[model samples]
Target: MFDDLISLCLTGSPPALPQDWWLRWSLAPATLLPLLGLLAWLLARRRRPLPLVGWALLALALASPLCRLAATLAAAHMVQLMLLLAGMGLLVLASPPRAHMPRPGPAAAVHGALLWLWHWPPLYAAVLGHAGLHVLALALLLGSAWWFWRAVLLAPPPWRGTALLALLATMAHTGLLGALLTFAGEPLYAAPGARAWGLEPLHDQQLAGLLMWVLGALGYLLAAVALALRWFAPGHPVRRATPAH
Candidate 1:
């Protein structure tokens, strides 16, 4: 039964039939148990709607049919990553304000490094083939993203400029990676399953790259713009108070 459960959790190969796509939900105990615990905690404490919504999005990305699709399609995998990052960002934004968060510069650097490391073709291919490695990769990605978001969002007003710079730097690196993938002459990922979905491997890779280049960078871009606007707004924490006549 344990082996059966493990087999059930494995995404296996891509679905060849259209109906199989919608039916393939990953009810992994490793994923579902923690999500259930989180849900109970959220309900018990009566958390705000934003965190709840974020939790739902996280569940959708990890436990829904999307998880199975991600195993086969690079583009679907990109969507899952984006959803996880966005969900983590929302959760951070809704959390109670705290002091002494890590500096955005170091956090951004670590997150960017991890992002690049995971995208290395050989490593990524291996991860997709092994469920344990795939989970570990996602855990590390989400952990770093959480740290980066917290650093940027919770930094003191005086450090907002630094945060903004870090955010833009992240955006730049991710966009550059995406551009590289998009323009590569051949398929970077060995996704033979893409043919089952009527997509050439190169085309699938390019689509994934486009999603990362545009959609992935969008979150950071919006955050950077907001931070800049707040920095220059009247009476902001970083702004000097004007003297009365």
Candidate 2:
């Protein structure tokens, strides 16, 4: 029985089209079992609906046809990465973990570094070709991003300003990376079957860059603006303490 399941988990070659992309979902036990366990844990703890929603996003990124699509198209891979990062942000915001990091700056830096490192052309190509490296890249990317979001979201009131700066910094770095990819004269990363999907390799990379630049910056910018609003609201504790003159 376990052998049968393991056989289904093999990392197959990239799918060629006119293959039905929607039907190319991954059935890897290694991915599915852990996600199921996490879902059970979330239910047992009775976490809020938001966290459950976040978990569903993570599951969709890993188990749906998007996973197989990522193997063939750079744009699809960027979408998968964005889904994972967005899900991690949602998870941390809804149910923040115990804050061990006293400041958001370092966490943000680490997270940004990991994001840039994985997207470096050589490393990106190598990781895409090897299953183990791909898994490791995902783990590092998600874990660091979660830590960064948690630190920013749960910072003490005194640190809120710094947290806002951290968010902006993240937005800047990711946007810069995206712009580089978008404006490059040639494709820096390889996509095995991009042409089959009507995208040349350079076009695929540019689309991915646009997704990261616009969508990634938007997520962090929205969070920063929300935090700023909360800090400045008239009913905030700091503002409410002003003496009645």
Candidate 3:
């Protein structure tokens, strides 16, 4: 019975990708709406222009074909996770130079909870099994990450120390989770047809853990550097800059 279940799970790979897989991935309903919203934002603020980098990152995060194609691989999913959580969140906060930063305490708790919950093996497997649920998970991750980063980046100068400590705590906790996955003797998840790609489930899981531990933590480190620079760089009150006409 257990062997039959394993075989059944192995056969459950993603639907055959179309010849126009790139086009489909890019134009997927999940991918398109954010692109349009970004375009509208750019058009509305034409006179007082925001940085293009943020917009570009947002487009890729929301519209890239790589995201859907890579879903079959845990590593790819981790990359997508980073793109949405760290990449898109950071870029969006960087856009409006003067937005108010939220309080770190609540934002950190929510973000940390969302991050850990979605990555739990059962929930992660469920997400892979259902397209709608996968989208919902992405939405929740992106939203929570945005809130967390906004709070971190927009923190007033006085709160810089607290923000830094919060970031360190986040990095430590998330990295610990990644380490747990990395060192586990057996696969923690039976992801959709994970064997179809010729990867053993344990190896695939290790790859995902490495991405989270290394790449995800790297994102936080970069943010920490940025924050430290802003906080400690000699005597210029870091006021929000007015967008240039």
Per-model lDDT: 0.78, 0.77, 0.65
> Lowest summed lDDT over 10 consecutive residues: which window, candidate 3?
1-10
lDDT of 1 by residue, 171-239 (tens): 999999999989999998876568888899899999999999998889789988987787778876642
Q: Write the residue-wise lDDT of candidate 3 on 1-245 in tens digits.
A: 11111111121444213343354235544456666776676666663333345566655544555454455567666776776665655455545535445677778889999989988888877776666676677678878877777777767665667778778878887898888888889988764435666678789889989988987787788888888987888995876632222
Q: After superposition, how far is residue 153 of candidate 2 from its true place, in Å?
A: 1.2
lDDT of 2 at 5: 20
lDDT of 2: 0.77
Ranking by lDDT: 1, 2, 3
TM-score of 2: 0.87
Summarize candidate 2's per-residue lDDT along 1-245 as a digit string, tens digits: 11212222223464535467677665667777988988887787786787788888898888777777776777888898888888887777565444244478888999999999999988887776676777788789988988888878777666678889999999999999999999999998877778888889999999999999999899889989988898778877642221111
Q: Per the 3 Å backbone cut-off, how many clashing residue pairs does candidate 3 have? A: 0
